[model samples]
Target: MSSSTQHLLVATAALGAVAWLVGVAVITIGIARARNAGDPDATVARARRMRTVTLALTVPGAILVAAAGGWYVLGRDLSIDPNWWIGTALATWLVTTFGSTFGRARQLSLAADRAGEHGTDDEDAQWRIRRVDLIARGELLLLVVAVVVVVLQPTAPL
Candidate 1:
């Protein structure tokens, strides 16, 4: 790849990473608000909004990662064999984007329904929120690992 193309790819990946991190922060804040709020409906609403934003950020980030990986393999004249880190990063992003985001969104939707039908303090709503929160924590951890791996770009034999 030309140096300019490589630099552009790097800049795109960096911007995506920053956006992902900001999404994570938003999610964390939403989770905290949900935990502290006395009104379950409000909590569910906040969570739903936050999850939507998180998914929005995730899509572009995943695209950027995939683009960078493609560039490394095709434009950089590098063998795919040495790009395991990119693969790992992409896999983690897939998990976070599809698995965690969709899963949590479903749970939050259920919680919202329960809150509307039953009550703000409904047991079902609370249970669903707890499950979504657990998933969010796992997603955050996976995101951290993905970011570290991408930044390091380990090229050692696997």
Candidate 2:
């Protein structure tokens, strides 16, 4: 592969990994804040939801890793092997961190839901929204990196 293409792949993988790490940190902070909030049920619910999302990411991530590995074996001259592994690790982290957050988020949501027939505290709603926003940001970053990898594919499109 040309040096430029190889660089793109590596950079994409690195960016993906960094984004995932940042997501994990943000979610963790959310969990801590949830724990501090006086609502155990809400925390549990959030944690569960995050867990589901994390698990869902694994299937696609594993496939991507396999594809990257296959590309490497084809003598494409792209060090996608390392990049693939990094991507896989990032996915794994997403699963683990989000899994931890899932239970808590679910709990929080439930509690908030029950707190009132018509509304909930603005703070609680905002907290959950922020956590989801953080996760979404991470996902967007990962997607951008994946697009970069696709664009850098060595094979010419017919």
lDDT of 2 by residue, 80-148 (tens): 354464354445445543543334445435445643433444456546545554554554455445445
Candidate that would win on lDDT: 1
Estimated TM-score per prediction?
A: 0.78, 0.38
- Whole-model Cα lDDT of every candidate shown, in order: 0.72, 0.48
Task: Kindly list the per-residue Cα lDDT of model 1 for residues 89-141, writing each as its tens digit.
Answer: 76787787777754555666778778789986788887777777777778778
TM-score of candidate 2 on Cα atoms, chains taken together: 0.38
Candidate 1 at 95: error in angstroms?
2.2
Could you say which candidate leads in TM-score? Answer: 1
| Candidate 2 weakest lDDT stretch, 10 residues | 54-63
Give the per-residue Cα lDDT of candidate 1 at 73: 53
